[model samples]
Target: MPMTKFLKNDKGLTLIETMLSITILGIVMLGVMTLFKQAYLYTVLNEDKTIGINVARNALMYMEKQNFIEIKEKFASLGNNGQLQLLVCEHNGSARYTLIDSNTSPLSGCSDIQINDRKYNVTIETEPPKNNNSDYANYFIPLVVKVTWKHGNIEQSTQLKGVLTSEDIR
Candidate 1:
């Protein structure tokens, strides 16, 4: 009778082990993809907020550059309604400020303008010089430009105040 020997050998991981590893890898990949998607959305929302802020700042700068006396004169013609008519203009690296009236109410042929958006109020206030002193004595008015908007269900505002004089104009 011939003697029979049994040989046991180890080669590589079993099919079940390989499949388990692949499943774990897939789960991890899904988690990473979800994280990336969220991050991308957040970045996009932030960029929109930034753009809104810039638009408000530009509007304020344009108001600042105007001749205080001229603005005052225009307001005089506007009467009490002038404040409500305050208009915004886009210029070269700045914005334009105008006053509208009931005649222009409903903002015919106008877009990209709103009194409030994102649950925040945007405002521009002018603080004229208390006294007139012609010689570098702050003859121009101080302007308060504010842009308020909402972020993540929270309201916030960005303000830029400046004391400008005729000399500051270029």
Candidate 2:
């Protein structure tokens, strides 16, 4: 009879135990949600950075392909106080490039670009080869290209530098 009474005393779960399990599950779920949020943010940031890099690279390549002599002549014609301008834009999901001279009165071209509904600003700065050795100055020109854009109220930028050598003129 004592064995039968002991077997009948079994209870599935107490109120306190049920509440405690619920609380633990809630905490774990909250942590997992936080992790997921962080991962999403990281992915967005990476995408933006990748686009900026590509813009800068394309600008560099465009400059590299130009005839150095004609570039120099164009600069001279502007009295050396002008800039070589490149405008990049997105049209129907494709990028288009336009080259212009800063001296032109209607100079509407800017380094800013719009890609995939996002706006990015790109700037290219060139330095006439340093005159350390007069001959070396004639042989190389230094260039820096920067890409900038806004990300969630914060500004981000990427820069690339290269030297155009006389040997590349051909």
Candidate 3:
């Protein structure tokens, strides 16, 4: 009988190849997780912005309920910067709230969110019309409240405007 040559060939991945594939997959997964984390942080920052705006608006609403003259006086005491003004006082007493920008007293149980190493800016503005009862006006003055904050690379603002009527004042 003649000797026959047997054919053989190496197939599938070796140990090193398997390890290299797993490493590549792991790197991809890590990158994805990093991206997800960044996105979540951005979302949280945005939520803060919204809350800051609402806080400012609520403050303004409280001011609106008071006498027109008292509005300016109380607001003056409160900080124009919005972030620093968390309290307003009258002859009776003072009310305390949270200032988004105020380093002295920040939101209760809340911490600052820094995205791209930038701090948020929250501002409030109250501008009354020069004329109290104009042809098309309802009140003596109009109060304008502006709230501003920064998220990532975008600057956002929310404004609340109301008219101060004689009826509103006591």
Best by TM-score: 2
lDDT of 3 by residue, 1-170 (tens): 33342223246677887999999999999999999999998998667667766655675666556666555454455554432333322223533333333445543444332234544343445464565556424335456656656655777766667665656433
TM-scores for every candidate against the unseen true structure = 0.55, 0.69, 0.47
- For residues 1-170, could you state the per-residue lDDT of candidate 2 as single tens digits? 59887567676777887999999999999999999999998998799899999988888888777766665566556553456556764556765676566445323333457778778776666666556787665656577777888987999999888766665444
Ranking by TM-score: 2, 1, 3
Lowest lDDT sum, 10 consecutive residues, model 3, at 83-92
Error of 1 at 46 (Å): 1.2
Index of the highest-lDDT prediction: 2
Candidate 1 Cα misplacement greater than 4 A, ranges? 1-10, 72-97, 100-122, 127-140, 148-158, 168-170
Q: Comparing candidate 1 with candidate 2, which one achieves the higher lDDT? A: 2
Global local distance difference test of model 2: 0.72
| Per-residue C-alpha lDDT of model 1 across residues 1-170, encoded as one tens digit per residue | 23342123246777887999999999999999999999999998776567667756766666666677676565456554334234544556554455444244534333334543533344555555556765534345565656666667777667667664554454
Error of 2 at 114 (Å): 2.2
Using lDDT as the yardstick, the better of models 1 and 3 is 1
The Cα error of candidate 2 at residue 131, in Å, is: 6.8
Superposed model 3: Cα runs more than 4 Å off: 1-12, 68-125, 128-133, 136-140, 146-162, 165-170
* Candidate 2: Cα lDDT at 154: 94
Residue pairs of candidate 3 with colliding backbone atoms: none
